[model samples]
Structures are given as C-alpha cells and as structure tokens.
Target: MENRNPDRATESCLVLMLKSPGRSKQRLAASIGPLAAIAAEHLCYCAFEDMAAWPGPVCFAPADEHDGGWLAARISPADAVVPQRGRNLGERINHVNRTLRMRGFERQIFIGIDCPELDERYLEQAADALGDHDVVLGPALDGGVVLMGVRHEWPDLGELAWSSTRLMADLEQFCNALGWRMARLAPLADVDTFEDLDALKRVVGEDARPARRALGAWLANDGHRPETQP
Candidate 1:
C-alpha cells in the first residue's frame, strides 16, 4: 500500500519534474544561454518552495541520479522518487505518475520549469478543479502543456505525445475516449525560442525593473545571442 500522509494525502500535491539546473536544454543557449537555464531553475525552485507552503505536499520529480542529490538538498527529502525508465518524455512522465500512485498520493499536479509566470494562483486553481474533474491542464501557447493534474493514477501515456504540436489535441481526445472530464486553466507561453523571449519582454514590460535588470545582466555578461530561428 502507498504511504499516505494523513494530513496531506487527500489534499493535492504538486510534482515538479525537472532536469537539474546544469543539464537543462542546450538549445536555449542561442537566446539566453545559462541565464535561460538559470531562470528556468529559479522558476521551478520558486514554484516548488511556494507550493510547499500550501496545505499540501510538494515534491520534486528529478530526472536523474545527479539531480536526486541536488534536488533533495534543495527541497524536501520526503518528495517522490526519480523515474527510472524510458528515454521518451511520455514514458517517463507515466513512470513518475505510477510511482506517485504507488506511494498513495491520490491527486497530483505536474509541471515543467519553463514557465516563470506559473504561480500559486495556478496551483490553487488546479487543486480546485480536481474537485469536479478527473484532470486539469494548463496548455502552453506552443501546443504543449505546462501543467497537468490528475485525480487518480492515469496510465494513458499515449494521450500525451511529447514535443509535438499535436500534444494538446491528442491529450484532449484521449481524455474524451476514457470518459474522463477535463478542465483547462488559462494558457501560458513557454520560453523556448527567440519569439518566446520577445513575448516575455512584452508581457513583463521592457522597462520593468527586475525584468530589465535580469535581461541586462544576462546580456552583458552571459554569452548568449538572440536566435535567428526557432
């Protein structure tokens, strides 16, 4: 049987599955370099820490052995285990979900580290959605998802085709076929391309203090250039 936290098991848990800071996607180097990675890591850390203060358990679903130690040192030791199988994203996420289910977590919300705009309000909304639906999704502008929450252990890994433009559509169809009610939160943009970075500047504002400071510091010293193409 899964180990259930009497105080939090029934409440929703947030699972942040991430590649350790140093091992993030290298394609970002053309636009933001290590700063992009740093920003992503900071976003994940902040979300995890913020959600930890919620009325539920917050877990880190680190991607590898190296990440295990690094993440454990930064987050709670009682968090979920790292996934052990699959080279593909779909299989890996399914593995994590299965592991969490085995550990007696009834509801789970999983997210990536790419969206800095993701905050506590989104987390709360996801949890609330679980009260009426079997799944909740926060779709990204890139036709992928930034957040997914499930009320139970769902093994429909086929629904989520990782890194594809059809991912959201596939998931929606899969949920319909499974007779699972699905809910959606507002869509957010993921920072993956130069266009994405440009959009961020617009949304956050070019003159915004922290935004400007972060971009200036990154551009000044970080050896990164704007991508000519996505």
Candidate 2:
C-alpha cells in the first residue's frame, strides 16, 4: 500500500502526545514501595524532554489540574497543552480523540509517557503507517498497547479494558468490530513491574538509566517488599 503524502502547506502533519505522570503505575509502586512516585515523576520528565523535540505538533495533557498547570510551564508555547477529561483512562483517550477530530485533525497518534523505547523513530514509523492504514497499534509486553494512531474519530474506545493483561487483545477486537484497517508496530516494553524495568536496564540506554538509579536507591533503602496488611 502507498503512503499518503503530507500537505506541503503545513510544516508538519502529525499530532504528538505527552501525558503527564500523576500517581500512575500501581504495580511498580507495589513492588518498589513509596518511592514509586519518585520513579514515575523522573520517568515522565525524561519522556517529556524527548517528546518536546519531535517533528510535529505535540499535544500534552495531564491526568489532573495540578499536573497540567505544572507541565504547561515547561512546554514551549508552540506546543499545545490540553486538559484531560473523563473519569477513566479509556474515556479520557476517547474524549481526546473526539476533540482532536472535531478540531480538524483527521490523522492523530497518542502515546503515553511511560515507555522508554517509544522515541521519535517509533512514532515516525507509526505516523508513516497511518498513510496506509486507518489505525496503527504498538503492543506492549504487558499485554497493553504502548501507542495507538487513528485517522478518524473512534468513540468506542471507552469500551476497551485499560491497564489489564487483556488490553492489547481487546483493542484488536475493537478495531476489527469497527472494520478499521489496523497496522502494527514492534512490541514496546514498558515499566509496569520490576521485571519490566529489569528488561529495560538490560540494554542500558539513556532512558533506562534514571529508572535504574531510582530502583537502586529504593532497593538499597528497602531490601524487601513491604508487607501487605489486611
């Protein structure tokens, strides 16, 4: 299939994503204890820095009002900062998609600030895939998707099971139900568990270094997992 050519009138025709970190990744926290918050914050900071330089219009949204304003101060005025709406992750994503589509953004891609390997090249590939397919998905090792791109408004995303092992599989079914042509990218490894972080550290890239440092500190301080209480 031939890829669609980008419009010459505009400088670039991509909708980048940058969602803020606000008490996310419970499994990681469960493994690492209270320091999980610190890890999340650091991971988000690194991702935001990298995504800010992507080759398109970047749209950032925070999970809450406090984080939104905090992130707004850091991003360039050229980039757009959007507030997250809805009570659930699926709802927020669907709302963002609908809003973007209504605002004349036909082709859009949304990624989170969780994955270290979800860099510019991966996103560029997703954007390029959009030229041929109606939807593109990047699967995560944890059975969740790390990236998703669509050429139109898909209001049915709220039905998707988020943050669960069934997530990626459910998304494929959702796309098939809508008859949207789906393209896929390589599996993305995200930091949901210590195992995920360990996997990332095996390669020792700049993205994985901060996480490793944070984990090392936590381990040095708290050698064992905190005992779960009734």
For candidate 2, the 10 contiguous residues with the lowest summed lDDT are 7-16
18-134: candidate 2 lDDT, tens digit per residue: 444446767887786665666677567656654665666667767777777777787777766667788778888777777776767777777776676766567777777877788
Clash-forming residue pairs, model 1? none
Q: Looking at model 1, report the run of 10 residues with the lowest lDDT sum.
A: 1-10
TM-scores, one per candidate: 0.78, 0.80
Q: Tell me how candidate 2 scores on lDDT.
A: 0.67
Residue 63 lDDT in model 1? 81
List per-prediction Cα lDDT, in the order shown.
0.69, 0.67
Model 1 error, position 65 (Å): 0.6
Cα lDDT tens digits, model 1, 1-230, are: 12223343338878777877678755565556655566556445545655565678666777888877777787655655555456777777788888877778789988877775666666678788887789988899889888899988777484367887678888888888889999988889876775565555455443334434464344444223435214
User: In terms of TM-score, which candidate is strongest?
Assistant: 2
Winning model by lDDT? 1
Deviating ranges (above 4 Å) for candidate 1: 1-10, 30-36, 202-230
Q: Model 2 segments beyond 4 Å from truth?
A: 1-22, 206-230
